[model samples]
Target: MKTIFSSLFLAAGANAIITRWAPCCFHLSASGAVTGTVGQLDDGQNRVNGPLSPAEYCIADGAITDANGRGCILTPPTSQWQCDTGATPTSGFSVACDGTVAYNGGTTFYECQTGDNGEANIYLTPGGTNCGEITLKADGCGSCPPPPPPPPTTCPTNLNGNYEFPHLIIPIDSSNPNSAAGTSYFGEVSSTISSIFNFDIPASDSGKTCSLIFLFPLQSQLTTSSFTFSGNGAIDFSLLSGVATVSTSYANAPSVETDYGSITVAPGNSYNVATFACPAGEAVSFELKAVGDTCLNYFQDYNPSPIGVYITTC
Candidate 1:
């Protein structure tokens, strides 16, 4: 026998009862709580006192029924509608008692109040007819969904300003994840942070990256590891122009030195400006671009053809 169940918050009045019409002519094989109201399987099944009521609703299509019998509310095959696992198992739906079926073999309930109260024929309801349908379990009650997941956390970085390009930092935003980015301090990049520097150029990647920072023609620092470079120049605010001469050294060959002349050119297609966040006083977001011989060769690694940059820019 298949069955379904629903929870109803029930409070027994001084004199209250419940009823459900049998689906068809069916026998009431007394098993569970309905034995009292049912009286017997073949004899005294469908009969009620007070307002026919059954708080917790359940279904059990029995093997028998009765035609003229309005007394067959309590039919055979019983099952309990247990509550869902929670402090309260009644959330999304409502509970109702239905007994429209006359006698064939329908649903029923065991209204166990403080009274010697007994069984009653009643199926669980979403509410009105043709509303919804549910399946019943032979073992335990039915099922429902679990709770919901939590919200995501928020973390913002200070990066808001019009930053011109003197360098370009490119990180591989791809499946391989070979993107490169770092902080660049002016002059010889020392261990400690200095304010005399013009601005730091952060690459497209993160972590302690060392690059030459020249505030035009003064101040410098050199941190250990990787290829290191630093130099200085002068930018006349009045003229808005400057020349920067930079020297380079590497961890493999620290003593060797190479010079790279830096200047502002038209925004080349090869160079991509990237933004960085500064967690400090008045927040600052910078888009820095510095493309020179020191970085990767655009023609070989990225574009594959030098003509692309020339033609695209032209």
Candidate 2:
């Protein structure tokens, strides 16, 4: 005989019943799914079936939402994943898990991380920032030259006077009739006449005396090496300007001698006047020599022998 079965009885005898059952809704209520048990069935025989599974799948559109309930999409499949943050790394530009970010060439910055062995975000300060765009280097410290040496001191000018002696002497030979041969003297006179003259004058006058001034003009600068004075002032004898007469008789012979001569003074470049004398007599000779300015003065004397003569004037 045919009989009706409740939902609970059918569920309990799910494997035993072979007859077709009417379709009913299996509602999933708030309390959850109901548990049932039946004998195990063969793998291919009494089982539910559905469409083949796909290698990749996605949920329905907008199925997963964030905390705000706004739908979010996953990134396309790739070997790596990346994020985009506004801040850049300290080092130069690089590819990382995050988006590309620029880095200052010389600046230093850091990020938050745990251990030590991680990517080092290092950079250098931007070149030429504080100092300005520097292409070449500026000069540095160096040494300078020392100051010049001081000038030299000068020497004091010398102020002194000069003088000379000019005279001639003749020797009487033994054979001369009018001369006492043994008493004749021919050597230089023994006196202090040869002593150097030392005197003083004004610096403006250059120690020059009157005679020198009267001879040369102020323009002529006289020096000890250039000029000197001569005469009795230089010695004991005063040089006289005039003619002289001499008459002599040999003490042991019979001949007599008479002589007349004239003396004259002329301008001298370096000294006072240079004197000249000439005596007149027959067979008599004379020699003239300068005796001043050591550079030009020298002793000279000459005589002609066998003279028996007289002179009216010289």
Candidate 3:
């Protein structure tokens, strides 16, 4: 009887060890398919056994083992869950809430529409799984302003004047061969007339006749009513002849004829009428000739003479 008791005790000890050694924890393959035996449950009721259903499995607890026997961690939504409505997602499609891939449903959340989707992709720093989108704007951020308009151009100033002819003398004489009665006498005659005459007379036969007969070169300074300067530092002025008197006498005869005329002169205002625009620190000279109808007449009818040249300064 003692030997029988010993055998029973040994058998009981062996059964206890077998029951304690059975595994309780379970895992799944990476393909989402169930694999391996489900661990034995300690509960008196036979609640755990066989393959696990999708609804019954807790994703976090499922250990993933790949086909190659590599161990991995199982995550929620083992498969890509597409929307049921068959609506295609446009660029910048996004999810409003954080959830597993299984939560993607046509009715659950909003996504960018295919044709009307207006979004921009953005890159985040430090690297993360979450990528986001931004709204499309008519004008993008930081657009450059248009180039500044070109500077305006400035116009140059014009300095001009009017002139008149009051008198000219061209003497016809056939007297002493060396007589001052010819053109030679007119040079002195012009000087004398300019010193005397001072008045305005209508174009008259007296003025025309004297001019035609005795070619006398006559001129006078013009009085300016106003003078102005341009932006370019040029001066502009208008002048009118006050009056002039000129007379000529033949070298051989005592006969003399007097003539009168008027004229104007305007030098460029930017420079001095007398000096022009001579450079600073430089010795410069200008020869200003009195010009206008009087000068024209002298050049046209009178014998060549030096009386027409005039000079002024700044």
Candidate 4:
């Protein structure tokens, strides 16, 4: 070691010529553990060789003393080498030293820096200070994995909104005289009516549960709604194509039946009517007709104004 550093002391003013420096070797495992130690070169010298993986630095001065001790002399691949005393590091590198720089006026740790020629270099303590010999050790740190992605959005089993006014309402077929009143039948005269309401399911809400909401003002109501009811018990209805024109009878139009098990024609201020699978898009219509003896009055002189109606989907 003395022969290696002897020629360096003869270089110009404050700098020295560095050669024969041993590499501070390290190995990173597949599991992310880092291990290795300072090693000697073929010529056997105690100097440092590095561009350290996690970065390293010294606490005090960048000079080594003569007495042979492991130094805090570590170099990083980056332009600067920085490592705090006790903080969680992003690169997972840690700092360690054999002894403080001022121990008995002797330096146990020394800092490494880049020379003007871009080689690793260390400064020697001025003539008087003693540099002690010491060994170095450090542990590796691994990074944490990323968090899991959020769960998918799900559809609820029940209806979840108030009666919203539909964009369009058209009267189709009804047994009551006022059924001829067109869209007004829903808000005007007392009638057991057949009508259609806008049911546009958004693409985003496809495959989600959906329902039609209604405001039934007056009643002698049945518990369900269907097209072929046994006599005068339940009101009948069909889902027609959204493009179908208004008609006194749409009996022959291509249609789908409302699930009888899902219909509720009972008297109520608000009711969620689940039609067949109400798929997304504005391609379908709801048409209801009161067959036998059911009186569903949307508006009556004795009752308040009708509450608007709409659909709900999730």
Question: Candidate 1 lDDT, tens digit per residue, 1-314?
Answer: 22232333221322111222432221222233333222222232232222333222233232121232221122123322222211122211211122222212223333333232433332333222222233211211222334455422211111122222233122211222222223232212122211111233334323322222212111121122122333231111111012111221121111112222334322122221121232122211221223332221111111111210100000
Q: For candidate 1, give the lDDT of residue 113.
A: 30
Candidate No. with top TM-score: 4
TM-score of every candidate: 0.17, 0.13, 0.13, 0.34
lDDT of 2 by residue, 149-231 (tens): 64322111111232211122232223343643231112221221111111122233332222211121121332321223244
* Model 1 regions more than 4 Å off: 1-50, 53-149, 155-314
Q: What is the C-alpha local distance difference test score of candidate 4? A: 0.35
Question: Residue 86 in candidate 1 has what lDDT?
Answer: 19
Residues 1-314, candidate 3: write the lDDT tens digits.
00000111111211111112322122211111111222212211011123322111111111212222222221122211121112221111111122111111211211121121121111111121222222211111112335677532211111122112223322322333232332322221121111111113233322121110111122332222112211221111112122211232222222213212222322221211221221222221111112222221123211222222221111
Each prediction's number of clashing residue pairs: 56, 4, 24, 11
Runs of candidate 4 with Cα error greater than 4 angstroms are 1-164, 174-193, 201-209, 217-233, 251-254, 261-266, 275-283, 299-309
Report every candidate's CA lDDT: 0.23, 0.19, 0.20, 0.35
Query: What's every prediction's RMSD, in angstroms?
Result: 20.2, 50.3, 35.0, 17.5
Off by over 4 Å in 3: 1-121, 124-126, 129-147, 153-155, 158-314
Error of 2 at 7 (Å): 99
Candidate number of the best lDDT? 4
